[model samples]
Target: MRADARENYEHLLAAAHEAIAEHGAEASLRDIARRAGVGLGTLYRHFPTREALLEVLLRTRLDQLTQNAGELETGSPPGAALVSWFLQAVAFVRTYNGVVALMAAAIEDPESALHASCETVRSAGTRLLVRAQAEGTARADIDGTDLFALIGALGWVGDQPTFSPRAGRLADLVLGAILTPGEG
Candidate 1:
């Protein structure tokens, strides 16, 4: 991609994240284009549909969180790393209200792009879980995928602004539940 095109795409992703975070998924693409200081045609050239744009926006954010697991593997204790990453997942769900609905909708097709995204989260969480177990700080009965599925279910709790106050506490609650007997 040309420099200007790359800049436009990044701007669009930022605008999309901001708009969706503030206005939910119902925010208009035209408005997002305006906020990004780009033309509608440019936005559409990068993303053919609203859902496709949102998928890219969210995938980008989730990918960052998943990648962070690798960075957190050092300095932070294994248990702390797992709990922190899990909490970040909660924030992602809360920051995008209908994200759970989107995720659920994609599960019907196992080979879909969303399925791969879900697996990325699961794999990242698995790294933490494996480390925690190795350190005797996480339960051996559960793996990363199970923890991720649980987080996906928890996304419903993040579906509205009214529930935002409980977000961190709820994250801690679930993380507590998943930890080894003596860990939390």
Candidate 2:
């Protein structure tokens, strides 16, 4: 890319990040372009779709989560690692205003722009869950899909104005249920 084109791309990403943080996954494309001081055509040229833009914006964080899972697996006990990673996953889904729904959808749709990243994060969590279950620290009935659903539920709680304050407590309750008795 040319210097000016790269600059515009960077500006669009910065603006989209801010807009998505403030407004959500549904934030207007036109508004983001306006905030970036770029035309709508330029934004489209850089990111053909909202999901495409989101995929780029969220890729780094998702990669970090994946890496964190590997580190936690080696550094922490099975139960503690699962709990820590689960909490961090919840926090990540709640970062952008309405990302919970987007992630939930993306995980289910293989063709979605965010599917690969979401799947990687889910698989990482699954590894932690499997380790914990093998150690008899976590419930054996649940699996990776269940864990991903719980993360989405907790993230959704954080998104709600009325229930947001109780998200942490709710997460604790969910974790309590997932961990075996005398564990966690």
Give me the candidate number with maximum TM-score: 2
- lDDT (0-100) at residue 181 of candidate 1? 75
TM-score of candidate 2 relative to the true fold: 0.95
Backbone Cα, N, C clashes tallied per candidate: 0, 0
lDDT of 2 by residue, 6-67 (tens): 99999999999899888888999999999999999999999998899999999989999999
Clashing pairs for model 1 are none
TM-score of each: 0.82, 0.95
lDDT of 2 at 62: 96
Cα lDDT listed for each candidate: 0.81, 0.94
Provide the lDDT at 43 for model 1.
99
Question: What ranges in model 1 sit over 4 Å off?
Answer: 107-111
In candidate 2, stretches whose alpha carbon ends up further than 4 angstroms from where it belongs are none
Query: lDDT per residue, candidate 1, 43-157, as tens digits?
Result: 9999998778977887877798888888887758998888888878877877876777776666555755676676677788898889998998888899776887778767877
